[model samples]
Target chain A: MISRLKEKGAGDLLKCIQCGSCTSSCIVNAVNEYFNPRRIIGSIVKFNRLPDQDPWLCSSCSICVERCPQRVNPLSVIMALRMIKYENGDAPPSRVFELIEQIKKTGLAFPLSNEAYEKRRSLGLPELEMDEESLKEVKKILSEAGF
Target chain B: MSMTLYLGCLIRTLYPEVEKAVYEVLGRIGVVFEEPKGASCCAPLGLFSLSKNAWLRLNERNMRLFQSTVLTVCDDCFASLSDAFKILSEKNNVRVPEVKPFGKFMLEKLEEKGLRFSFKGLRCAVQHSCHLLRPARNVDNAENPMVVKNVLEKLGYIPVSYVSELDCCGGLVFEEKMRDAIARRKAEALEKSGADCVVTTCSHCMRQLKSVSRLPVLHLAQLSALSMGANPEEIGISEILLRRMVNP
Candidate 1:
């Protein structure tokens, strides 16, 4: 699991000193105590165990990334954990899935509504049209990424 | 004096007004910019959790379109593109263009002068987007970012100090109740500060703050355009905000 996390770009997570700075600065932890970065990293560093908590709860604000004295980017570790869980059949939230599907089809996560299109036209902004080639390329990348 | 503007999905889709503001402000400041044709999304943070390779590849595709410099209004897009640029440059020797966030880019341009401001005395609260300052690489003082505040100050607006100024807006949180709870907390802090309006660099922070805050929220570009005498209507400045924020 540690090796996988390193492969997923969280190589420095082992440097976590359990200083709790990450948890102290965590915005999500302030609102919800269950999402503790220190505890999560401690478990991973000590036992090489994946966190029992939902890694998606991390808002990716990266305050933890800034406050970590050991230079362990807790946000990246959390993201790495999320990728491992997701690739192993754990589903992300439905809204997240919907965003992926939207990107797959339109090459955009937030496609404009008709009202929005009218608004854009009224604003005199140029129409943002994605060419077929770009869309095909994006879809190819998404599939290759296992989305 | 010129750059390519990458309008991330949020500003391009949900809040086209911000796009207008970007155009108005950049034009007023003599910074010529063009939106890249067939530009895709910036590959949102969720994509990183799925596959970092895909995220980098997609962002690299977008990065290839811009020749010299790329300016982004959304902090998420700014962070992702900056990260991809760093990693790809180190690994594959890709020649990624410089990525500048809207606030920092505007600060640099407006500091050069020639633009005039028509509004003053409006108390504003600035939300420095987390991604722009964090992982401690994008900026030096991530703990107390003043990029947005400095830009507002340059334009004659009073950036009021407030508690929870450094708190996250929880814009990326997947849970609704938690997201709103965090936004609400920030809203209360802003309200207590007696700020007439909120100014932010990121569209995600703007969207999240607007959802819960009673005070008017404006992207830094929108506020700058209005201050520099752009037509309020054309820049999508609401009559209420214009009266409260500009005329006050």
Candidate 2:
């Protein structure tokens, strides 16, 4: 019931009837039991504490959302839950954290460490460039946005 | 115009051939690139895993470093960049990084920073990245998607309709148990659809679909490069079938 949850399109949690149709149709649960959409909804309906790690199991595939007769976007609910977990520092994996750190340091993700760039250049590909001045402009825009 | 090419993890490690093809194609289209040092994982994996704050902060740092228009040949990177821009702009109230779902981000970014570039239209099938189209809800139509098709048509490619246009390729769930079934379903849809070629934004989907389909799956950049007259072997899709349609 967090205000941000409302902003993220999670207003339909009340409309869910617990019929298990979403559970049956969810591909995530078909492979991984931890990804039960019904259980997550049950917790929300009962006002019980939402499980900390359960929401992270979602791949954001939207299969459940497509199948739900009630129009309840279970993925959005999971996303809202994840936001709470993120703020509380209960994140899922270290690789996720490492990746974010890399992006923060380098403009692109997946460090070009594998020498893929050189291989590309050997194929007669041109070297890409964005000088410091342009980067400064982008930073200026992001800074203005409170980033 | 010269720009930095951003190749994500999957392309670098799993599909270096794709990287090669994209480079050749872009070069043919008169697009030049400089690969920056130390770029790594756009953190879409983290975002997919629901690490929002981590995803946000990391992408924020990327936004800070990039001053030039960013050009990416990978749909995963493109989707991640677009989604990150949307998320950060929403939270921080700043300008959304002018990025196209395909090759537009780098071009638009250049324009924003006072550079000039012209785009010739491309004929292709736009494989929408799941995160951008499904999660971010940035795509206009969920059932019958058109963002990528519209972009290509505007750029000059005859956008062809395909059956797997809106189907999932099981990219995110590749590690899951149902991956084969999921991939099969996506492959069937794409094969049944009659696109001249399958052009996608996500590298993961490209890889997944490529594994299952006989039809050629080209990255949007490769298609652009091909249309601009890059040789097929140089584009790395010469061996792939170019049949008009897959048997249903």
Candidate 3:
């Protein structure tokens, strides 16, 4: 499991001293106690599985990444774990899938609604339509990348 | 060198007001910038969890659209594109354009022009979003980020210090209630700061704070445009505050 995590670009997972700085500084953990980075790291290192907490709750804000004294990069470890789980068919939160679907459909994570389109026009902004060819290229890249 | 404005998904779609501000302010300052012919999402954080290779590849593809420096309005877009290009350039020796956050880019331009507006004394609470100030080595004084404060001060506003100045808005958290809790906490701190409004560089932070905070949330560009004499209707901000800002 450690080797898989390392291969997934979280090679510093073993350097974690369980100092709990990640938990203390975590924005998600500050609000919701369920998504604890320190406990998740300990569980992954010890039991070779994620804890019962939802790992998808991580916001990728990188505060934990910056604050880790051991340079363990808990954020990268969480991302690596998420990638592994996703590849193994662990369903992420529905919102993530919706975001992916939106990007796949429009080449944009936040697509403009009809009202927003009109608002742009009223505001004297240029049309934001992604050209057909570029959209095709974006779709092709995502498909090639296994999305 | 000229810059290409990279309006990533968040600013281009969810917040067209930010786009207008960027456009007007850059034009007013006489900075030469144009929108790219083809662009998409910066392949934001969610994609990294799905596949790192895909994220890097999409960013590299997007990077090809701009020939020179790329000025990004969204902090996530700045971090994602720059970090991806750092790795891609190391491995492939590819030529990559410089990726700059809007605040830093504006600071440089204002410094070069030796420009300073009259102090309006409008108190602003600044949210220096995480991606723009983190990973330590990438930014100086990451712990006590002054970019937003400096930009606001140069644009003639008083940056009111707040207890939760460094707190994340939790825009990245997928859980609705948890996200609101974090944002509400930050909003409460900003509210207690006695500031007239909240100012931020990231569109996600603006969205999150605007949703939860009673204080009017302004993008740095929006504030810049307003202070530099743009009408409220032109920049899409409230006219009353605009009147106080422009005439002051």
Candidate 4:
């Protein structure tokens, strides 16, 4: 388990001292019982395995990092574990997928109609246009980026 | 010069006027924008916990759409794209294209892609997105709240101070009841801060802040637009109101 985490550059998990600082600082646990950084770390250290779905409760907010006295970045640890799950085809729900679909169908993500553009121009803003040449350039850039 | 502008889901759906304001403002500053076809969301919503492969793939695809450069006016978009770019570039051992925190990524990507465009120095306040500040370690002084101040100072904006500038607006957890109290506390503190206008990088933060405060909330792009002489009305502040009447 340590090796797996280290593979993601989070070898610093060994630095944890079972301190309850992170657990006490966690906002999620304060509101919800599902999240406890101290318990998560204990599980990782003792059993070398994280609950398959329990870690998803984290908001990924770095409050724990800011409050930790041991300088252990528990958020990164959680992220590294989540990344492993994602690679294994266990990604959680994402609003981004729907958003991407919206962008594909519409040149602009927001519904910017011709009338809206005209209104903007009437307000003295320049016209926004998209041509085939510009589209081709955009596609090329995404391809190179491995998109 | 010409660059692809990344408008994230929130701005595109909830506050599109801000997007228009960004274009109008940047245009006055001599920044030419192209609405790239086939552009997609930067996928910030699931970024922190999404599968690395999916997140990186989506972001790389999103970044690839711009020919010369990419301009992300939304702070969430900037933070999401920047994180993905950093991770993918390092994992794949490729040259990471520079992503400008303000709008310079537009110039750099365009130049790298061999697209021609010209731009002038822009003076603007860059509000740091909370996600970028809180979760991400790349930002400086998240606790004291100075990432946007530094960016604006670097880009030449007179930085302003708000008492609760560093406090969370409770955006990420707004669905939680506790968020209301947290946001109100943050809002009152920030309102007392002496900024002429509040400039933020995150659409969520912008919405959350604007919902509770009477002070004008400007996206970094909106502030940039104001500096470039775009009318504040064009950004649709009046249309953005929630219509909740406070009983005196």
lDDT of 4 at B171: 65
In model 3, what is the error at residue B216, expressed in angstroms? 0.7
lDDT of 4 by residue, B123-242 (tens): 222335666666545555566666565444533355665444555566655244555655566666666665445667778778777878666677766544544455657766433221
Clashes of each: 0, 25, 0, 9
Off by over 4 Å in 4: A1-11, A18-36, A46-57, A63-71, A80-147, B45-48, B103-127, B134-140, B143-147, B150-164, B174-182, B191-197, B212-215, B237-248
What TM-score does the A-chain of candidate 2 achieve?
0.77
- Summarize candidate 2's per-residue lDDT along A1-147 as a digit string, tens digits: 545565644648878888887678665665556668888887877675665345655656675776677888787788778666666768454655554444344433345544656666666644433456544543443344333
Residue A55 in candidate 2 has what lDDT?
65
Model 4, residue A51: displacement in angstroms?
6.5
Candidate 3 residues lying further than 4 Å off, grouped into runs, are B243-248
lDDT of each: 0.84, 0.60, 0.83, 0.59
For candidate 2, write residues B1-248 as lDDT tens digits. 66666777667654556776666555544566666543445666555445455556556766765655566666567767777877788988987545544445423433454432233332355566665555435445655666666545544456777654665676665244456667776666666665556777678778777888766777766654544456656556554332321210
Judging by lDDT, tell me the better candidate of 1 and 3: 1
| Candidate 1 lDDT by residue in tens digits, B126-222 | 8878888887665537977877888888887889999988899998999899999889988999899989888888888988999999988888888
> What's the CA error at residue A101 for candidate 4, in Å?
7.4
Of 1 and 2, which scores higher on DockQ? 1
| Model 3: how far residue B163 lies from native, Å | 0.9
lDDT of 3 at B223: 83
lDDT for A120 (candidate 4): 56
TM-score for chain B considered on its own, for each of the candidates? 0.94, 0.72, 0.95, 0.72
